[model samples]
Target: MKSNLVHKVVGSQYPLWRTVLLIIVLILGLGQTYVSTHFYLLYNKANSQHHDVHHEYYISVTKPINTVASMSNPNANGFTNAEIKNIQNQDFVDRVGAFNPTLFRIVIEPPKGMGHQDFRTLLFLESLPNAFLDVDTTNFKWKEGDKYVPAIIPRSYLDLYNFGFAQSQGMPQVTEGMIKLFVFNLEVKGPKGSHKLQGKVVGFSDRINTLLTPESFVNWGNETLGSVSKSELPEQLLLKLKNPLSSDIGSFFEENQYEISKSDGAKAALTNLINYSSFYVWLNGIIVCALSIIILLLVVYLSIASSKTEIMQLFFLGYGVGKIALPFQKIAAIKLLMAAFISLPIGAVVAGMIVKNSAQLVPFNSAGFQLQLLLVFGALVLLICALVVLLIKVRIKRLSV
Candidate 1:
């Protein structure tokens, strides 16, 4: 009977308790995996959204303008009219083709009290760039049988302002009458230009149109009016660049180092902006990962410590002699394996969920998701391995006689 009991105890594996403990550890591991995955996804989504918003806001603030000068007299600059036009045409083409056109700002300021309908109608007539204007519908009474007024500006004008024109044709016509029209001072350049402009709001398209007219230019005050002189004009005709991707521009400008002395400061400012935007997400991710590792290590240590009494009891129950038979190596191996296996998948799932859910909340680029997942999973695996090794070493030492 004694020998049979001993054989049963030694040969039999750990009872329900150890299995229960392992299950609990696995549950904890899975939970951590889910949370970690979710956190990573959230972080990536936040980072991408932050970058887009920063880029948009930065572009809005930094508007660039290309200046073309038309000389008063060809003899003044020792150049012919044709040469001057050629130079300006070439310069316009080169500059417009080189950089992002959408970075330019086209402001259209109609004189106060102008009806939105009339303004919109005139816009279609003039073929102006689409203008972002606030309409006060409450005060203005709508007139029946009045055609819908469309913003008017030419495709060239939109190109100049780095704006895209609507595809629809036929703008609404406005009644022929003198309305309050102001001059527009266009600012085309990025943040560097904005700084140079010193917060000066450029004249609107309507204002520029009013001022450019032969009669209007002649009547304008001399002090407030200026024209592009031919002498300072460039050779290239400025045409808008087709695509505005940073990478595309980078590739285009690879050979030609178009150095802007002022861009250094602007670049530094942009870096700071990006850092500020992404700081919170980065910090949170770090904290969560750290906490997870610490909790996992603590659980492993407690499990090892608690298993000692049970392991010794099993040894005596299997053998006649009341001898300590704690197989520390096997127990430690199990603990290490369990900790690692449990933590990895849980972290990955959590990170994935977080990323997927965050996409719903913000504009996320799907292309980046897989890359992020791979990076995060790799990090989690490394972390769990490191923790398991450390815990196993400590447990083995404690069990050694």
Candidate 2:
């Protein structure tokens, strides 16, 4: 048959060394690209859950208290309206929220039947705009005459009492569920005289350290019970950044002698580093893929050169270019297909190793990840094969002429 004749003549010219080299590059290219893409996806998932980097993009900025200077002017550390306006004009800042602190004295009486009836602690409460809250509490709003107040305390506060203070004092540790169920009283006192407001824990925040109520509650409390006749200016500002990793953010904060949370800065730095590394890895994979494609073209040209006489004679004998190029195209396709198959298992094993070593720092669904990788790598190989097949036909036509 004509097919059999074409296969025997062209297939014999495939150099063994060139075939092996092509396979190695293809596997290296496909496997590295898959790994880099997987890393990027995993990082995005982790950021979404933790909001440590890239997710919320909010940080609390405050001026350092100067003890000696504060004695001369108590409001020296507080942000002036002009200072806030200057920060709002910065290119990196999307918006800023001021912390509304309670200007009246607050006494938190413990819930009844907790073994210590006389237990009371002096507590400071602050609030930000509802949009600036890291934790969502639907019940955390208050208006004038509302006796019930919902409070959000930091998780670190509970941890400190449960693991440190309670243990040292031989007191019972309370869980979040237990604490939420208990009702407490906020005894607020100022020039307007003392009043008791029923308070309940609505949620716990991981991002903020201060106890938070609703902004409306803080504003109303300041107006009604504040020692001063007017509300105090904010001592701290919460900034929503356009990009947390921007160099201008650090420089601006540093120049103004403002302090940012160390944890937020470190997390953003780590995320930026990972992003740059992933891009370089992805670029390298593309280079390897390009090299492999170049090698494939070289193999086709060399094979055709060696078989130039036979190809010309076949063309003279009424054999079309497609018939002569079929065997070469099939060999290239098979090599690419084999590389794809081999890369899958290699990629899977490497991915498994990463998931195992990551130790739940990032969540992974092995089955879903593998399926995505397969679809993506398959498309890449298909495109490469299509290009190779077309190039093979053109090469054969030129040699035959």
Candidate 3:
């Protein structure tokens, strides 16, 4: 019976409590890393394409302007230099461009074949850089001898004429291409003097409103006819956001009481989702790590207690604590190292399977370089195993032989 008991005690594996806790810790470690990594990759992939994460919208400050004359520097628009700089510095904005106001007044004579009587309209013109213009500018070029000033009008004007003016006046609705062929005379007046120039519509824009001309044409027209600008700054600014759903962009506008032209109201929600998921993943890791440490301590204590008889016998036989403790230390180190080694490949395979399946659902170009993911997981495993082995060594030394 004594010999049987000795064999039974020596052959015993980890107790049920230790085994269950070890499994839980192992699962948590693998799961936390894999889940966090998947979300991280998804977030990066979403941000990388950036074809159109959000819809196109316009932003401007909202100050009181009761009347045309009540506006603060209406001729210069409401945007100040400091305000422009503040907007441009925002991380969400991809680019910002301001409208260049025509220093001249324009008198429009009715189209040649449109009406029988004398009809005229007074208007102003604004222009932006060619890159911002959506129209084909091949024929929009200019020379001193050119008769017609090529103009790219807004699509809103077409909608108005189609649904409002033409319907009310019993006139035929016109198409964009047809309108481009219709020529009208512009009596452009500036501080220098007035000149009559023929102008024609070349194309229409979906975003920009008001009459738009070439930047070169506007500069030449302003220099030749219009008086020098009273204010150097532009009257209207065009802000292009890099990410439409950015919370920073929305918050800034709200805090400043700025007006937005259009908002999809989706950016803030998406960003919040990413942030919340990240926060939860971190919280889970922290909790699991704490629990793992506690379980490790308990396991160490229970293991030492189980072998107390043999350990004490060794001490009484002229053997040192170091000699008896060495086996337990080696066991602890080997178990942890093996777990780390096994878990690394398992975690990697799980991550790969998830990414591959996700690609099938919504295809994306796989990353050619994933050294960051490998390095991060490898370093974490190395660090955790190293710390656990060191702790095991210390615990073994403290065991009373």
Worst lDDT 10-window in candidate 2: 359-368
Over 1-401, each residue of candidate 2 has an lDDT whose tens digit, in order, gives 87888788766887677678878987877677666556655655555555543555667888898988777777878899999999999998889998988888889987667667888998888998877776676888788787678899999999999999999999899999988888897898888777888899989887777889888887777778866424367898888777777788889989999998877767656666666676677677767777877877787788888888888888888889898899888888888888878987887688668867674665534446556656766777788889999999998877765
Compared with the true structure, all predictions reach lDDT values of 0.38, 0.79, 0.66
Native-referenced Cα lDDT, model 3: 0.66
Residue 35's lDDT within candidate 2 is 65
Model number with the top lDDT = 2
- Report the C-alpha lDDT of model 3 over 76-111, residue by residue, as the tens digit: 346777887888899987678878777778888876
Q: Mind giving the per-residue lDDT tens digits that candidate 1 earns over 1-401?
A: 64444334432454567555665654464455545455546555666666533332111111123333223443232333464344335321222211111212323433345324234211101111122111212222212222222122322454433333223333333321211122222222223232111111222232122111111111121113322222222222122222222343443233333222234225535644555545555556556555655555555556556655644565445521222222333343455456656766665665556556546776655676667765665566566665556555655355543
* Candidate 3 Cα misplacement greater than 4 A, ranges: 1-13, 45-77, 81-221, 225-257, 261-283, 286-290, 305-363, 368-375, 399-401
| Candidate 2 local distance difference test against the native | 0.79
TM-scores across all candidates?
0.35, 0.89, 0.52
The numbered model that scores best in TM-score is 2
RMSD in angstroms, candidate 2?
2.7
